[model samples]
Target: RQFGEGGAELFHSHRAGGIVLPTGTVRVEKLSASFTELPGFEDGAWWVQDAAASLPARLFGDIKGLRVADLCAAPGGKTAQLILGGANVTAVDISKNRLARLSQNLERLGLSAEIVQADLLKYEPEQLFDAVLLDAPCSSTGTVRRHPDVPWTKTAADIEKLADLQRRLLARAVTLVKPGGRIVFSNCSLDPLEGEALYRAFLAGTADIVDDPLRPGEIAGIDPFLTPQGTLRTTPADLELGSPERSGLDGFFAARFRRAG
Candidate 1:
């Protein structure tokens, strides 16, 4: 409750598990606290989410009352982000089961979205949205710390397979947004083939879309992680130089695209 009483690199979990930072996060100082123990846990002050995983949703500066689509959204973190910004979101996920969890989470947080169970590859909306957030499925190499078995279970071939799925999903996302609307494509994979390379290919084929590059200070402390092409790229290797153990952010890549009419 009193986050800033003393500042010691404590972070607040904005439910990618953590956000707000230093003063706020799921934990208090070096101590790991249970979800039930954290302030507002029962009241839905926030959900558990990795700090890095939460960044992509902030790409949209403000969108009060706008229609947005959160594709592949389940156990909805980004969906919550969009809702907090006052977007009327259609949260779509192929897994009806996961969407159930999403619904429960939002209900606890006292937020709501038009939940839909549909596959990103084939689900067709009756109309386009003003914005689309495609946190596309990938090999998830970026989240190895949270799920340690990821690296061991995944291979280059696995990345190729997931990359293909990402490609198809992003292609469908492009179709789902209103002309001149924006799309933020993100994946929790450090692989360029799945993140950066996918964007490059999409650019080549689509004449009506242009890169909506991220700028400096857009998201605090993210300057070093940005690519020359204006995408945020992170890795497990990007931990703070001195404190290798404690200070770290997840490996993630995100790029915004605008459909140019």
Candidate 2:
């Protein structure tokens, strides 16, 4: 709607499926056709991303004109969100192929960002950013609804390894942001080891970081997903839409932190 795509009516008129999200995202409950086959998709009115995938970027809130580093930002959904939110973004990804896809998406949306292909562990920037969004890679157990093969393909060992990798990426993310800047760490793993446990351990070791919890009423339809720790955790069993099949979002977990100045 922000891009003048005409909201749900646009999809309805085209006989497509869509439902509005609190974050202004149009969730297509049932796609009548492929994303490219959907009307206005080629025109870049919107991009394809799960509603849960959109949360981590929103955690920064009102990032207009802020310099933000989007680490591991391939496929560019969150990066596009940052650009549309008026942030100057540098999208860094390790995969060249993925970065190419990200570039194409940005071009289609008529948005631009500094796209860098480099490992987060080895990449160095001239200056720190005002904010950082680390959507770390995980076991992807959260997306089993769409990709049901996730559990079969990924083992518990994979989750453990990914959790360790996320911790390293998160630490690196903190270093890329300036003091007093905020960071939103997120992953699609439902495992606590990759979500709450990892974040808590990081906090225990890092003294200069403080929790920046997501408060109720900040985001519509999000109260049910807020945790006692102030983090956002959405499971496959959450978000009662209407029917069984239409309910719930991807099992995603997100937590925000502010580096002490």
Candidate with top lDDT is 2
Give the alpha carbon lDDT tens digit for every residue of 1-261 in model 2: 233334346654435556565555666667677778777777787777777887888888899999999999999999998998899999999999999999998998888999999999999999999999999999998998878888899788888899999999998888889999999999998899999999899988988788888999886667778998889998877655565535567999999999988
In model 2, which runs have C-alpha deviations exceeding 4 angstroms? 1-9, 12-14
Show the lowest summed lDDT stretch of 10 residues, model 2.
1-10
Using TM-score as the measure, which candidate wins?
2
Per-prediction RMSD in angstroms? 4.4, 2.1
Question: Tens digits of per-residue lDDT for model 1 on 2-56?
Answer: 1222221224433323323431233333335664665565666656666677778
Candidate 1 has its poorest 10 consecutive residues by lDDT at: 1-10
